[model samples]
Target: MEPLFRLEGVVVAEADGRRRIDGLSATIESGERLAVLGPSGAGKSTLLFLLNRLLDPTAGSIFFRGRPLQAYDPRELRRSVVLVPQRATAVSGTVADNVCLGRRIHRLPCPREAVAEMLAAFGLDTGLIDRDARALSGGELARVALARAVLLAPEVLLLDEATASLDPPSAEGVLRALFAGLSARGEGERTVVWVTHDWALARRLASRMWWLERGRLSRPPEGADEAGAEGETRGTAAGEGGARR
Candidate 1:
């Protein structure tokens, strides 16, 4: 089967001749959990933007499901390949309005039950549904963003430091709920590409991991120690839980 995405000599250069991504060739398999790790300014966020066509590359080609990204309508492509950026953002309105923005955009019905369920799944209180979105805390905003993206049921989910604002325990809980939700949707139905600096979290969530540096990709160093001693076991357990779907 064809990979979900294929990049050939992809390059993204700024007007000043700075290359954010230089000759990046890669293949992202369908339904795979891919974790991209790198230092700050390694073009991690840029890569996600490229995937969903938020930005065009200066050179080379990117294919989504075997079709050139440029061939698809940007609006249509984004509905299937959703990206949640690191910063928490909310528009002027109630939480429900923000959470159901995608549905509204697609002219789909925004059922109250579905919205409530999504908020609950993300560890958010359904009561907040009527609250002003702009009044939310940073962590709450982050969870709200996540809930919004997940509710869209996108084919591919790109997360850029999505849970960075939450505390560790809260982050874990939210992620566990996320994985459960994805599993319930059915295996191989969604692909996740997460960009994070947390090695242990990456190992726990991703089936495959890659290192991006200086606009290039490479394998993570073998035998690199995880932050926590139980990281390996937790990773295994997470995979097992997902497989049970």
Candidate 2:
């Protein structure tokens, strides 16, 4: 199957004028669950930003479906490749209002029945649809974001620590629903690249892992001591007690 997204020699600079990502290149196959594990300040978030077109590379290029990303319109790029951020800041609106915001913005047709079903599938009460966005809890806000993103039917899904704030049960429920709904399309029609510091979560969801350290990419053995004593495999964060600079 053809790659859905390709990054070649992609580099990004930090606020202090430092090159955080130095010449990184990778191919993202359609419908593959790829986990990017890295320490704080390892450019993991920056990489996701680049993939979502929230941030452009200082150098190098990205291709979507064999076409250069630069050739595509930014608005269109976002419509096709959406990012569901970790922090849940609900847009000011009702539950159903927020859920269908994407479709409204893009002028896409959406079914009300489908919207209600998605809300229920995400463990949200249908009555909550009439409630204000700010009234929802962190987990509820997270579900709303996921539902909205999925409703857009994006070709590629970029999850940046998306489940970080949710309680264990809520997080697991959301993750299960995500994979069950999307992964059934096989490994060649959709794509998921989730960035997280949680190794256990990565192992549970990602089929392949890429480790990042100090702006460089590493494929350290899954359970190698190099990943530190997190006791979890794959992209678990190294210094959980503190953030990296």
Candidate 3:
């Protein structure tokens, strides 16, 4: 399959000479759900930021559909490859207003109808439409953020700790909605790269899994349980901050 998103030798470094991502390379095909597993500081969030073009790599390049990302307008890139951050700060408006913000910025036509459909698809009630965006609970805010991102009809979705703040049930609910929405889209129309520390959730959702440590990315080690035993073990080491993610 052709890759929807590709990173080649990407690296991100700070002014203090600390490298957050080091020579990382990966490819994600359309419709693929990839789980990025690593200990805290494994550069997982940085990777998402890079995908969203929120961070420019100090070295190497990123390509979207065989075109260098640098060639695309940042606003256009983000509209096509939406990132739902771990903790989103809701804009001061009704939930519906915030969700429709994307189409407004893009000047996309018929935003109201599209926003309503998205809320329904995400299992959110219409009542939330009138609710204040900033007043929602953490989980509620997450749902709104996700709904807003989906409104963009992104080709690639970058999720950095998407469900981290949600309780288990709520998180599961959100995942179900996400998968269902993806299925409803045209074949090969979307790709998801979700970064999370939760091994169990990864096993349940990911079509493939990758592990990161010390700013490097690798496939799951040979003989490691494909169903998350490795993720749990890695979690312990991850607690020590070796990954500096």
Output the number of the lDDT-best candidate: 1
Scored against the true structure, residue 76 in model 2 reaches a CA lDDT of 92
Candidate 3 weakest ten by summed lDDT: 236-245
Q: Tens-digit lDDT track for model 2 on 1-245?
A: 55778889988876787998988888877756778888788888888888878888999999888888888898999987889986877778888888998889999876778779779878889888789989998888888888888888777889888888787667767876876555442243567788877666665556567787767777544564444533223333422221111
For residues 1-245, write the lDDT of model 3, one tens digit per residue.
55777899988999998889999887777766778888788888998889878989999999888888888999989988888888966878888888877767899763566677878876678767888888888777777788877766778888888778787767867876876665565445567888887767766667666788767875455644454344323322311122112
Compared with the true structure, the alpha-carbon lDDT of candidate 2 equals: 0.76
Clashing residue pairs in candidate 1, if any? none
Cα distance off (Å), candidate 1, residue 53: 0.3
> Lowest-scoring 10 consecutive residues by lDDT in candidate 2?
236-245
* lDDT score, candidate 3: 0.75
TM for every model, in the order presented, reads: 0.90, 0.85, 0.84
What is the C-alpha lDDT profile of model 1 across 49-124, one tens digit per residue?
9999999999999999999999999999999999999898998999999999887898888888888998999988
- Pairs in clash, predicted candidate 3: 41-243, 41-244, 41-245, 42-245, 43-245
RMSD in order of candidates: 3.5, 6.5, 6.8
Leading candidate by TM-score: 1
Greater TM-score among 1 and 2 belongs to 1
The local distance difference test score of each candidate is 0.82, 0.76, 0.75
Residue 59, model 3: Cα distance from true site in angstroms: 0.8
